[model samples]
Target: MDSIQRKKLVNELISLIEKGNAHVSFKESVTGLPSELRTIIPENLPYSIWQLVEHIRIAQKDIVDFSSSAGSESLAWPDDYWVEPTDTVTDEDWNNSLQQIEKDQQRFQALLEDEQHDLFAPLPWGTGQSLLREAMLIADHNAYHTAEIVVARRLLKSWK
Candidate 1:
């Protein structure tokens, strides 16, 4: 597709993703997760709802930063490369963060709409696909983890 067409298509999909993620709230989304479910590690899963949110937040923030300042030093990988699942966070923090993510996603989309295809090109951070590719990945990531939260809630008998 031509550059203008690409921009329009990218913007359309980005709008859908931004809007789609807006409706998903950590609390209501986790309506199915019970206290017990949140704590279970049946097979010693490396991540919990807490950990997942932490990872996603870090990722989204990184993307926004990268989008705005392509010349800034990129985020470096952790030397330890170990993710801790016990991070403490309030449900409110998670929801607010997600809302911010929606905003960031929209901004990134707008920027993409205004720049050349190379603007959205992928970097080494992750999802070495185009910006549009990474945005969709973000949407998929949110859906995947939000679904996990729902599973935890239902397992806890917290769902109505």
Candidate 2:
């Protein structure tokens, strides 16, 4: 794409990352959540809200890491991407996970916004992956899991 098209695409992806403009945004999904409800596992659901949050954070962090030149080579999927579900998760853990997600979203946006970098070029460490691909992946993955959190919260009547 040309310079203008690239900027427009990056800006669109950034908006998706931060606000989920056309759908329920991540912030909208997680905002105003009660600490007590964070770990609640509603019936039939495989993971709690906290697990989903941590998973999103972990996955997003991995995407950010992989987008950079220094990203690690051996990342274990499922094991590395998810934390064990628990009955007693601390508020600090929840807060830190959300903070990390926000931090990494900013990091991803920075990569997209850096005009010096070629967004379409594959990372040196990867076979065929570009920053643009990763940014889209992060946005897609976050939206899916954030929707899970929102539904879980609604099932438990914790979201209002």
Candidate 3:
């Protein structure tokens, strides 16, 4: 794709990502929360929000790596990948997980440079797809989960 065309596409995708992020962590825009909300998922499920964050973060990191190195794929999920609250998840643990998410997001954004940054070129090592398309998928995936969290919190009366 031409440079101008790519730039436009990238910008549009980025806008979608921004909107998704608002739902994920910025509850202020909403009228109010349900009364109880944990930044991470609850303790009962097999996977707390933190573990999910790790899984997603790892996925994005792999995307960037694959984009650059080509042909690489995700490793097996660690035993902890399926874990839930474990009875003792600290505040720092949650904060650290969220921080990791932010860091991964930034890394994905940085891949967009002034040149050819917007085009969906085929991955260097993958079957087919440009970097921008991969990024778009990531953004959409994030937004979907963010919205899910909102709905789940509402259903569980976990938003506060």
Candidate 4:
């Protein structure tokens, strides 16, 4: 692909992951959540805001790690991606998880922007997954859970 096309694709992928064009961005969904409500599981929901945030961080970090390195280790599905039901999130834990999410997302964006990486070419270490596919997966997965955070906030009467 030409430089111009690569630049455009990078921009679009970044926007999809970072912006709230059609739905709430991850930052928008998590910001200003009350401390008390972060751990409160809304009725019928499987996760709280804190749990969702941690899950997003873990999953996104895994994807970024896997996409950027051939020797990257995969986390166990479901269990490794989510916080335990009985776990408690302190202020430090919450802040750390949020910060890591932002940092790792920036890492993923850098990988996308780097000219050395081929967005469409499959990683030799994986089955048939490419950087492009992983980018879309990150965007989709984060968006899905971010929406859940918003809904949980709404259910708790915390969202604006």
Per-residue lDDT tens digits for candidate 1, residues 1-160, read 6777776777666755554545564435654444344434434344666555555666666666665564645666752222465535556765676677567766777666765446456665544656666667666766666666656555545556
How far in Å is the alpha carbon of 51 misplaced in model 4?
A: 0.9
The better-scoring model by lDDT among 2 and 4 is 4
Which tens-of-lDDT digit does each residue in 29-125 have in candidate 2? 9888888888888999988988898899988888888786675565687798778878887878777878899999998889999988788898888
Which of candidates 1 and 3 is the stronger one according to TM-score?
A: 3
> Each prediction's Cα lDDT score?
0.59, 0.85, 0.57, 0.91
Tens-digit lDDT string for candidate 3 (69-123) = 6556656656523344444555676557666666766666667644644345676
TM-score of each: 0.60, 0.93, 0.69, 0.96
Rank ordering of all candidates by lDDT, starting from the highest: 4, 2, 1, 3
**Candidate 3 wrongly placed segments (more than 4 Å):** 1-4, 21-47, 71-73, 77-85, 114-118
Question: Best candidate, TM-score-wise?
Answer: 4
- Model 3 / residue 84 / CA error / Å: 4.7
The predictions' CA RMSDs to the true structure, in order, are 5.0, 1.4, 4.5, 1.1
Supply candidate 4's per-residue lDDT for 9: 90
The clash numbers for all candidates, in the given order, read: 8, 0, 10, 0
What is the per-residue lDDT of model 4 for residues 49-89, given as tens digits with 9 covering 90 to 100?
88888899999999999998988998998889998754466
